[model samples]
Target: MAEFEAERRMPAEAEQVFAIVGDLDRLSEWMPTPIGVRQTGDGEVHADVDSRDVHADGLVGVRPEQLRLEWGSEDSPDYAGWLQVEHAEPGHSSVVMHLSFLGDQPEARRHGSAAGEVRQWLDDALAQLERVVAGTS
Candidate 1:
């Protein structure tokens, strides 16, 4: 398995940040990709993502301060990932995201490209969130 992680500090309060990440349906508004998410059951979601080069069915898992997903295209092995929120201070929060693809996919693990992609995705997503929260977007 491979791993990618990124962190962003938001001016918004922890509760507010948590509220945003907790609702799966709001992902399209702040996530980097134009993705639509739907909850299928407990700890499960389906993502209709349009921005990435590949398309896949995503399974979601959620906790009070964390969200996770497992995804794979029809012909490829699955990838798994999670987003976590941590309260850093009053009216401040941090987001951490981690992603990993199956071990056998050489392309997925080579040159840390997968990790870089995920980091960039999270960076953009958080910037958007900051804009929205700060009433600048």
Candidate 2:
């Protein structure tokens, strides 16, 4: 399995950050991949994923108390991830996103270049999240 993590500091409180990050339905606002999400059940959703004309079933667990969100693809066990919001310096919050690519994928995707791409994706997603938190996006 390959794991990657990205973090950013937001100009907001932890609760304020979590309010945006913890919303499963609004994933498209910051996720950079999924275009839309519909809740299928408690902690479960169907997402219009990426450019693929495919709707993927996903599990999303939101913990307001901990300011954390966990998600994974139910259709493909190869993908799983979590997002966490924590208190930083006063008037600031730290957000971290972690992704685990499990099992087999194409050769190119398992290489160093793919790792860079994944990191870029994560960075872009976090930048979008910052915009969301700031009410700019």
Candidate 3:
């Protein structure tokens, strides 16, 4: 799998950041596109996501203790990722996003050949997340 990690520091409390990121339905507010999330089970287990322009029918795992969310392609498990928030500096928190995708896919195929795009998208998503957190702060 081709993978990359991106980090962003936000001026918000760790628990607050976790609240925002931990809510699966709020992903679209920061992500590039709307994420349609449905509870697949317990808050600590899985959630189903339908990001029409991105991953469709993806399964996400939530680890609240670590403030992390993990996801993988439901169809083939070819795409996967991790999103986390950690306490940082004094009052601020840091967010880290790790994403991986199976290589050698056609451009026509979304996840196969878009590593760079995915990285950039995550960067933007983090920035937007900061703004959202700041507004609520």
C-alpha TM-score for every candidate: 0.71, 0.83, 0.77
Report each candidate's C-alpha RMSD, comma-separated, in the order given: 3.9, 2.7, 4.1
> lDDT per residue, candidate 2, 1-137, as tens digits?
78889999998999988888777667778876535677788889887845446578999999999999999888998888899999999888999999888867531254676677677778988999998888832
Overall local distance difference test of candidate 2: 0.81
- Pitting candidate 1 against candidate 2, the one with the higher TM-score is 2
Clashes of 1: 0
Top-TM-score candidate index:
2
Candidate 1 residues lying further than 4 Å off, grouped into runs, are 34-44, 48-53, 65-77, 104-107, 110-116
Better of 1 and 3 by TM-score: 3
Query: What C-alpha lDDT values do all the predictions have?
Result: 0.63, 0.81, 0.71
Top candidate on lDDT is 2
Compose the digit string of candidate 1's lDDT tens values, residues 1-137: 66666778878776677677676676667877654656565545566655554445555555653433334343444566667777788777777776666667533563666456556776888787777666631
The candidates, ranked best first by lDDT, are 2, 3, 1
> Can you give the lDDT of residue 109 in candidate 2?
55
What value of lDDT does candidate 3 attain over all alpha carbons?
A: 0.71
Clashing pairs in 2: none
Lowest summed lDDT over 10 consecutive residues: which window, candidate 1?
Answer: 65-74
Residue pairs with backbone overlap in model 1: none
